[model samples]
Target chain A: MTAPARTTSAAMLDEIRFDAAGLVPVIAQQHDSGEILMMAWMNRDAVAETLATGRVCYWSRSRAALWRKGETSSQVQRLIELRLDCDGDTLLALVDQTGVACHTGRRSCFFRAARDGDWQVIAAVETPPDELYGDR
Target chain B: MTAPARTTSAAMLDEIRFDAAGLVPVIAQQHDSGEILMMAWMNRDAVAETLATGRVCYWSRSRAALWRKGETSSQVQRLIELRLDCDGDTLLALVDQTGVACHTGRRSCFFRAARDGDWQVIAAVETPPDELYGDR
Candidate 1:
């Protein structure tokens, strides 16, 4: 199936009704498999950069800077398509994910489930955390 | 099929790794229909209250207070099951939703699609926005 093309930065950014913090919640999903990989915060600048470069960029609330996905880790997310939810409050990013999307080297950040009152890992790490981050 | 039982509030809350803002993003999905409804923020207290009462409660970022689901709009979301993501940074609430979930009275907040480089409303509002938030 062919992916939908992204809109111009001007039109796309205008559609987003950013919060007072100038941020929106973004969900990264694997394009072909329909697997949700991770959720992160994205500021206006990050969203613009992602559209311009096709590399998913996020705002690290902790670091307070533009986070180019896989800048340090090799689990890059190549933007295939970008979507804005109806209210224009959240973003859905379809991407061609590299090795892994989780900091833990797992395929996704949503690998755990609260089952029977206990947390269980439903998915395993594709690469070791140490190798993916590599001291950063 | 019966719903999965919820864990004790004490045990479940301990598993959430709230961000520096003491907030976690919660995704509400229609239990039987599997329809993604809306996403909201939740604090520890809201999480505990929701679990204890079986009413999906959330923290209003704008109001900075507890937001009881359907407090005014009659769009209550009753908890069916709650899942904690692998990183413990996000939560998924399988809920039995009553009435509309979006402020716009659409069945979901994700009603927009970025089609052909333009934004389009993919889903129609089931109820008008005015009646949903009446006098509030």
Candidate 2:
């Protein structure tokens, strides 16, 4: 007997409504701990690929590639839930994460602290990208 | 001699460019561990308050009020870092978080796992709304 066909974009598209830019907002969260990680945009293919595989996939507006979260750091995000807002233009993805989520090598891209009406640098975990990304 | 006054919106506004809606995207991250926490929207005042108090403040689109992260739950987000995108339309905030970031009671909002063309429920930390939020 042959295996069943995989779920395609056409099937999932009914529930997901993309914006005019063909992008849907994706909210990332930790799996076991249940903390929100970050939010980004994903195109149809990115969503489809994420569902097709356990890995969280995003459309990188900057690089224009299918960004599999943690592909570089091996801190892959395993999808848990994909929710749509009332407008159907946004998505909330619950995921299990492995390592630092930010490219800066920090657990997240957010790293600034606001104090005394000024945005100040407070905490950082991983080393800055001068060494990781190699000089800008 | 008097101490210097804190930076005002007039000065900070010079650096930030809000979208037509007068809302800017704010990214949240963990403080001590350096993990990406979450992303939300903020208006001009919310930005000012976050800086003034060292607490993470956001503009709630649903309620239209200034939301202090972890206000209700005591899982506060202490401001650590605030960054600006090249265009100055987006804001990145690094914060020190106290508790779970998700309404569901998880450390993060993300908890679903996607695998084999389907979204699978992997981990759940927070209790359901019926228990946590208490029936709206």
Best by TM-score: 1
Over A20-116, each residue of candidate 2 has an lDDT whose tens digit, in order, gives 7788777675755645456688998887777667578899888998888766557678776565443455567767876667666666553443344
Report, for every candidate in turn, its global Cα lDDT versus the true structure: 0.81, 0.65
Error of 2 at B42 (Å): 0.8
User: Compared with the true structure, what per-residue lDDT tens digits does model 1 show for residues B78-106?
Assistant: 88877777668888787899999988888
Clash pairs, candidate 1, are none
- Kindly give the stretch of ten consecutive residues in candidate 1 chain A with the minimal lDDT sum: A1-10
- Candidate 1 retains true contacts at a fraction of 0.46
Model 1, residue A47: what's the lDDT?
83
The DockQ figures for the candidates are 0.42, 0.18
The positional error of residue B48 in candidate 1, measured at the CA in angstroms, is 0.8
Q: What is the lDDT of residue A129 in candidate 1?
A: 82
The TM-score values for the models, in the order shown, are 0.77, 0.59
